[model samples]
Target: MINGDFNGDGNLDIVVANEDDGYLAILLGNGNGTFTGPFYSAPIFSYQISIYAADFNADNVLDLAIASSDTYTLVISLGSGNGNFEDPTFLSPENYYSANFAIGNFDTDTIL
Candidate 1:
């Protein structure tokens, strides 16, 4: 699970990889120690899936990046900054069984 102000609403929110259900779910916080939603992403159909969050498109909205070992691919879910995300973009990494990945400016290009 990961937490951040995903909706730009100044409230903490959560995103979790639901391996059992094959989806990524989000829980939006209400700022009063309560949360709502299990807003789900598309089914990943993988047994082992991991997730990370960031503004991958430089749009200042937090997005999600998921790695699925069963599918041997990384999926990107660009956020709409309103607690919702766009469709995923899949990429094939050199390591087919990559269980996790790092998001950063590895090339010093100021991009993720």
Candidate 2:
């Protein structure tokens, strides 16, 4: 599970990795300690082990970074600033299986 203000709504939201179902579940918050989702699903295949959130494109909207151990792919799903995500951008890394990642401006150039 990953938590962030993905919708730019000022409330914390949750995105859960569901490997068995091959999708991610989004739970949007109501700011009153109540949540209102599992509203959308982002489809993916194989076993997903890790998920992270950040504004990968510098759009100020939180996007998802998913690592799939079984599929050996890194997926970047850009957010729409309204609790929705676009279709993922897929990447194949040589040693992706069972892999994990950290998101940051690694080069200090303000890019993630």
Candidate 3:
């Protein structure tokens, strides 16, 4: 589950992982006591554990970091700002950590 305001626009988006077909659901914020989403017409993601969103590149724009502990893999997605996102330009495949990683800036702008 991705409970984050990745856009930095102040509306939290929730992305629920459908483990059946490996798809991600992006629930948009209505900004008025309601959230309307699950805007998935097709399937996305393939076997994932947990999804985290943050500024992984220090670009001030929030991005997504998806972890697959079952596969010992950690994947990341860079935000596109138009309600969609993409993967990182540079990947750290060697860093195969668990999906449910605890992330917070410990004074170095890092999400680990």
Candidate 4:
């Protein structure tokens, strides 16, 4: 699971990578410690193991980057400002597995 203010709602929300179901589930928070969701993403054939949240596109909206082991790919799902995501952009590594990810200005270019 990963947590962030994905909708810019000032409340902590959660995104769970469900490998068993081959989907991602989003749970939006109400700020009072309550949540609402299970809003799912399209099926992915790999086992999603880690999730990171950041503004990957520099669009100011939080996006999700998921690492999957089976496909050895990093899938980026851009947020739509309403706790929803667009179709994922798939990136495959030369290696055969990806288990984790981190976001930052790794190149000192002010981008992640």
Ranking by TM-score: 2, 4, 1, 3
Give per-residue lDDT, candidate 1, residue 7.
92
* Candidate 2 TM-score, true structure as reference: 0.91
Residues 47-87, candidate 2, lDDT per residue (tens digit)?
A: 78889998899878999889988888888899999888899
lDDT score for candidate 1 against the true structure = 0.84
Estimate, for each residue in 1-112, the C-alpha lDDT of model 4 and write its tens digit: 9899887889999998888877888899999999997688887645888888889898999998888887788888999878999999888666767787677897999888
Candidate 4 ranges with C-alpha deviation above 4 Å: none
Residue 26 in candidate 4, Cα distance off native in Å = 0.6
Candidate 1's TM-score = 0.90
TM-score winner between candidates 1 and 3 = 1
Model 3's alpha-carbon lDDT is: 0.66
Going through the candidates in the order shown, the clash numbers are 0, 0, 0, 0
Q: Which 10-residue span in candidate 4 carries the lowest summed lDDT?
A: 92-101
Residue-by-residue lDDT tens digits, candidate 1, 2-59: 8888999999999988778777788999999999987887886566467888989999
lDDT scores in order: 0.84, 0.85, 0.66, 0.85
lDDT value, residue 71 of candidate 2 = 82
With candidate 2 superimposed using the best TM-score fit, by how many Å does residue 84's alpha carbon deviate from the native? 0.7
Error of 3 at 86 (Å): 1.0
The residue ranges of model 1 lying beyond 4 angstroms of the native Cα positions read: 93-95
Q: How much RMSD separates candidate 2 from the native structure?
A: 1.5
- Ranking according to lDDT, highest score first: 4, 2, 1, 3
